[model samples]
Target: MEFQATLGQIVTAVIGAGLQLRYLEEYPEPFWRPGDLSAAAWRGRLPNAFALVASRPG
Candidate 1:
């Protein structure tokens, strides 16, 4: 959300670059501790970050 690009835009750009998307997943918890108590507790909410797996064309 912070970035100007949307998730769909990013995926499209990656695909356009000749990389195939293998997997995409959202994290359940913050990778790092946040100052907010809710985020620090990782209360099973929607993730703020995500994991994307892409591979170059074979």
Candidate 2:
């Protein structure tokens, strides 16, 4: 077997904001459709919930 080593090698990827992911504790799948999720799934339905992912590799 042959092996290759990588040191401090960084790849590239994309990142964006205003993204939201809502999963259920009982079942990870959405109650309805895949994207048919609201911001008020866990809390008392305040207003908004979101997540931000880094776009570029640092």
Candidate 3:
């Protein structure tokens, strides 16, 4: 899938994550953020998996 978001969001998220982890952060927003992306900000940062299972309304 393609990646979305302007350069600002990318920069902000990266910097925030970096400061939070005290390292150079480099990871996409976890869980969900439009496009299907995989990122690793700080070391030991757990990433979600493929084929998400969601429940439907009755």
Best by lDDT: 1
Q: What lDDT does the true structure give each of the candidates?
A: 0.78, 0.32, 0.42
Tens digit of per-residue lDDT, candidate 2, span 1-56: 99643211211112123223232123233334436555554343442222323332
Per-model TM against the reference: 0.60, 0.16, 0.26
lDDT of 1: 0.78
TM-score, ranked from best to worst: 1, 3, 2
For each predicted model, how many residue pairs clash, with residues at least 3 apart or on different chains?
A: 0, 1, 0
Model 1 misplacement above 4 A: 31-44
| Candidates ranked, most accurate by lDDT first | 1, 3, 2
Q: CA shift at 8, candidate 3, in angstroms?
A: 0.1
**lDDT value for model 3:** 0.42
TM-score of 2: 0.16
* Candidate with best TM-score: 1
What is the Cα-based TM-score of model 3?
0.26
Better of 2 and 3 by lDDT: 3
lDDT of 1 by residue, 5-32 (tens): 7678989999999999999987776677
The alpha-carbon deviation from the true structure for residue 9 of candidate 3, after best TM-score superposition, in angstroms, is 0.2
For candidate 1, the per-residue lDDT at 53 reads 94
Query: Which residue window of length 10 is worst by lDDT in model 3?
Result: 48-57
